[model samples]
Target chain A: MTAVATACPPAVRQGGGPVPVVSEGPALLAGIAQGPGLAAHLNRLGPAPRPSLGALVDMARDVDLRGRGGAGFPFATKLSAAARRRAVVVVNASEGEPGSHKDAALISCAPHVVLDGAAAVARALRTQEVHIVVSSEHPSLRRVVEKALRERVTAGECLDLRLHDAAPRFVAGQAQAVLQLLAGRENLPVTAWQPEAVSGHRGRPTLLSNAETFAQIGHLVRVGSAGYAAHGTAGEPGTTLVTLRGDGWAPEVREVAHGTPLADLLDEAETSRPLLLGGYHGTWLRPAQLRGMTVSRSAIAAAGATLGAGVMLPLAQGRCPLVRTAELVEYLAGQSARRCGPCLNGLPAMAEAVRALVHGEGSVRRVEELCGLVVRRGACAHPDGTARLVASMMQRFPAEVQAHSVGTCRRGREVSG
Target chain B: MSEHQLRVDWPACKGHGLCAELLPEVISLDEWGYPIVHEPVKGEVLAMARRAVKACPTLALRLTLPA
Candidate 1:
């Protein structure tokens, strides 16, 4: 109902912000491994065309643009909700998932694209302010973004860019958490729901998106919607940026066309081991199941998995996956904000159950019960996402679970507690 | 007559279980002893919801009967 928003003063405007890792599509990651300098970004993408607010929304809808922050929520819908009300752009670069590094990759390699999109949103909304939130842990990334902002200012672009360092924790990247951190409060999500578009950013409508979502917007502005739609399937336009890891190799960022075969991006012949899609909050699929799967939201959903913040880990064949999953659950449990009972209490209980099962100390039924108890119970999707990871691992690898229960891991693998 | 709604401030609710006892039709306790809102507290169930809200020791249960 209100289109007026006051910009909050920059808090430690040097380098800190939200932690959502980006799944920047190929377009966003254009000129791979290139310098994040303003001149390089300008040379690569050319000048971004200014579009009316209405035109921007239509562009997003035309290409079926979805947030690459992992939820895949249609970007157009969020744009429309905050269209006329107000705008303060918050970019999530936190990479909350421990395994994800795509957002940081973009910040390090292409900071301009993220800012270009963030500034465009502010310019469209007439707010003229944008905030890029990166993890406090990444000092070099902070320097990179700081350098990018300085370059933009030096180039005579009159945009207000504020950088704030935030706690480098999983939930710290949630939009609500970002807002809270910016407010200098404890970084925890509120229980009651006011859509950020309704009352975000100090109680004014704000456009909140991951760094990659803004990268997509930046590309959309550079190329009209059609040009942007040139890549990927008609259903899911644009390429996808995926962070590929596992097998003890250093994590790498790969950009591929939407719906590109999962087999293509990953070395399928690496091992016959099952792969985990969608990071820690994602599901595990057998190699056979992952064979024909594609990277688009619809295809990933069809494969009974999510491209969760674009992390794919194909485990090393010799590692006991059950033990690995147990460790992950324990980590997730510790990451809980601890405001909701189900998440706060249930996660540790679930972790205990999974740990027990791994050590031949308990039954899978307890794990299943804990999973059921936790879903749809927390204030945020953290608990539900955690449950999904646990439930899927149990369903996907019954043989592994069975072996763990019998105090043995798969043949040739030692069960480590 | 407009519908009534029930919500729990999860962080505030101490899993006292009184809400489940009073408003059994709309509330149930999970294994962790947390109250889960299972149904809408409208129609005849509104009265039960009100009792639960009043009896809530932590004063965390909220019943939003339309004004």
Candidate 2:
């Protein structure tokens, strides 16, 4: 670990000793919100340690740092891959997933923590070129990040950071699409599957990950591996932010330790209705299946579901899940990049078939067949994800499928859709 | 000689279904008329699979061993 000369700009404790705004967690979100400047962050966490590449890689592996983005790929592996033939590091803060605000929350509320992490990773990789990709939907977020970049620059830290505004589309947040967007090309996945770490933006080896992952890297630097591991479970250590959304309540981004019960975060004793784990490309779990689950990735994997990018929303009791499923499928269908025939033709066809079912005029067999055809047939996993959501809807709620099939709802009333 | 798998360059394929027509034994059109390689092209079908790749209008189909 190397400590550079400090120009931390007079530690004044911005809001009188960092009162936690969004969350009061054991890690990252601890003292996240500040009033206006970097004084509070500098005073609280001190300057983030500029660990050498070897040290950062070892620390990442020791603390089990996984990308906070949807895929949750190992950060150490990504770093090591980037070490060879890599020059660029991209901070993906697009936060395009529906009902997901955790990354956006980090960028808006705690910009320094994210910026510090990016600096650490970029410096360790021995490259100063860092690009931050953000969606234009949140002008305020862009403003906040811009302010943070200036603060880091004033602090005499040198990481040539450039922020690019991107369209707020679902696929726009994807790693490949991000590379293309940065290059001023169309934001869509290419037919070829080139590992971004090997050949990324400008055809150089690039280290691209979710914005929150870099924030966690900052946390990992402040509190070394052991301190970082203090909060979460042994298998998956450290705290993670979850954006909780439901029918009655407005969305809230809460930072909780890994291995916390999924039910506990839902703020309910137990829900009888189904839940959507991960984001749209995630899984649908029946109440019984989700009851025993924790936030640990391995635990979720043990049950054959990925705890993807952490968007938890339970279907309200009164609402028909199939109706929601149909709506979600249509949304996902519209999100397809339209690069391939299977996704282009299959998604719209699947959407129509699902819409027909919701309106009481399609077969379960037909929907299943469409799901069968669309899986693994795209440039990206968009079609497969949409199909998985549909399949899970069918599996989790058989009675709902039956009711809609006979031109009636689960309540035995006429299917009103 | 190395064995190669029949594959589709997803973003390029326009669903012309010519690959399906030329190599029906290995490639078949799905409900959407997109080619789905049912099995690996081997022995007897290898020659036909090469012809199918050459026949694709958009040059979207490939017969290459995956790396």
What TM-score, over all chains together, does every model reach? Answer: 0.89, 0.90
Worst 10 residues of 1 chain A by lDDT: A1-10
In every candidate, how many clashes are there? 11, 0
- Model 2: CA > 4 A from native: A1-21, A246-248, A411-413, B42-51
Distance (Å) between predicted and true CA of A30, model 2?
A: 1.3
TM-score of chain A of 1: 0.90
The chain B TM-scores of all candidates, as shown, are: 0.87, 0.90
Identify the candidate with maximal lDDT.
2
How do the residues A284-389 of candidate 2 rate in per-residue lDDT, one tens digit apiece? 8877887778888888887667878888877765667888888888998998888888888888888999888877898888999999998878777889888988
Error of 2 at B26 (Å): 2.5
